[model samples]
Target: MRLLRLPEVMYLTALSRSNLYRKIQAGTFPAAARTGSNSVAWVEEEVLAWIQARIDERGLPDTP
Candidate 1:
C-alpha cells in the first residue's frame, strides 16, 4: 500500500517527467493522487499494473 513519488515512478517506468505527464494527460497512465496542498503520489499497485499491462501487450509471459 505504498504511494510512489514522481522519481520512483519515473525510475520504474523508465520515462522522463515530460513523457509521463503527457501519458497522464492523454489518459494512458494512472492519475496521481493529491497527497497534500502541494504534493502528489501514485498508488504503487496501479503503477505496477500499468507496467504489467505493457508487458501483456507484448504477449510476454510473466517473469520473476
Candidate 2:
C-alpha cells in the first residue's frame, strides 16, 4: 500500500516527466492520487503493475 512520488515513478518506469504525462493523458497509465493542493502520488503496486505490463509487452528485462 505504499505510494510513490514523481521521482520514484520516473526512476521505476524509466520515463521522462513529459512522457509520463503523455501516457496519463492517453489513459495508458494510472493517475496519481491527489494528496494536497499541490501534491500527488501513485500507488506503488499500481506503478509496479504498469511496469510489469510494459515489460511483458516489450519483452524487456526485469528491473533489478
Global lDDT scores for all candidate models: 0.98, 0.94
Give the worst 10-residue stretch by lDDT in candidate 1: 54-63
Clashing residue pairs in candidate 2 (N, C-alpha, C atoms within 3 angstroms): none
Using lDDT as the measure, the top candidate is 1
Question: Global CA lDDT of candidate 1, please?
Answer: 0.98
Q: For model 2, how does the per-residue alpha-carbon lDDT over 26-45 read when each residue is reduced to its tens digit?
A: 99999999999999999999
Ten contiguous residues minimizing lDDT sum, candidate 2? 54-63
Candidate 1 stretches greater than 4 Å from native: 61-64
Give residue 40's error in model 2 in angstroms.
0.3
Against the true structure, candidate 1 reaches a TM-score of 0.92
Output the lDDT of residue 31, model 2: 98
For residues 1-64, write the lDDT of model 1, one tens digit per residue: 9999999999999999999999999999999999999999999999999998998899767789
